[model samples]
Target: MKNNNSNIKLFIDGFKKFQKKHDNILEDTAYTQQPKAMMITCCDSRIDPSLITDTKPGELFVIRNVANLVPPFEGDLRHHGTSAAIEYGVLYLGVTDIIVLGHSNCGGIASLFSNQNKIKSSDFINNWIDIARDAKDRTLDRCKHNSQAEQINCCEKESLLISLQNLQTFPWIKDKIDKKEIYIHAWYLDLASGTIEAYNSDLKEFIPL
Candidate 1:
């Protein structure tokens, strides 16, 4: 953390790869952007939606925040970064799907159950992490006998479901869901095993994707 600016060279190197392939993509999407999905995920360095999904530029409209949490819809208009991105991606960009992608060993998720050092005292992160409080509660109640690791894994996935429900709290999102214009999905990535599990609406469980 000494030299925070040191990573710029890595980005510049990545951009070189991007530029080599950008010409063909820019030929069609330079004028308009039509991403396939509005994807919400965690800001963890290990989880990159584009890299995980094997998607190119203009393929997915992604929004990342701590724990990939989504707040309940409110009438008040303030600086809601994640919500604003969701609105723009869904309403403005006309994305056909919304994905709440969660992952294992998420630090934000661990903070929910942490008692060693308070992780939610930060100005914005504390209030932001509050959105997942219910998820932590549910995990504790459901997985009380499980190990800490298992509880966190459950909580991580539970947070995804909660966010998906919160997405429905937005009138436009609900209307679209009702009208069959857009669909919501939950996915869990196990970084250790390199396996992805998706929530099955019918069975009400997570299954390997």
Candidate 2:
């Protein structure tokens, strides 16, 4: 683990350097418009959506969340950052593509498979993670005899499929999909191999992206 004091100092120094570099980009982005393709990815530090896609700053509207799970449309009091971002990207920004990106060795997916009691009394996190609970259950039921790593891999792929299904629950998304104005895609990044696989709807399987 990083020593707290050193980490703090490093963060401050990094921020100082980031300010210098970010200012230039910010100025250019202010005058330029955003891209029409958006990517929803995991919050895992190892998985970078831009790096994986080799996209520039304005090339993709990216949303990062735990497990990259998209919950079904709920008009409740939840923040729904991912959903909101999707809505804005489609409705306001007129983005034509939405990519739900998942990855290997996901901690959130691992937590769903393990006992929930291990986590502290954090209802928000537990509730938020419930979005991927169905994926975990399905993985367990289908891969009952598989190894832990195999189960995790199943969940990772299943989570993307689940999110794709959830995307249809949004009325605007469904409308765009039906009119062929927008396309939804699911992708998986293998951290170890630095390879990405995209879901092939026709083949009903994941192939190299």
Best by lDDT: 1
Model 1 bad stretches (over 4 Å): 1-5, 17-24, 116-120
Best by TM-score: 1
- Candidate 2 residue lDDT tens string, 37-141: 989988898887777778767889988888888989988886878888888888988889999999998888877766533555576777878898888888999
Instruction: Give one clash count per candidate, in the order shown.
Output: 0, 0
Query: What's model 2's overall lDDT?
Result: 0.86
Q: Which pairs of residues collide in candidate 1?
A: none
Report the lDDT of model 1 for residue 78: 86
Q: Please provide, for model 1 over 1-209, each residue's C-alpha lDDT reduced to its tens digit, 9 standing for 90 to 100.
A: 46876778798889899888766666776788899998898899999898889998789999999888889998786888888899999999999999899999988888888762357479777778889999999999999999998998999999998998999999999999999999999999999998999999899999999
State the lDDT at 18 in candidate 1.
86
| Candidate 1 TM-score versus the reference | 0.91
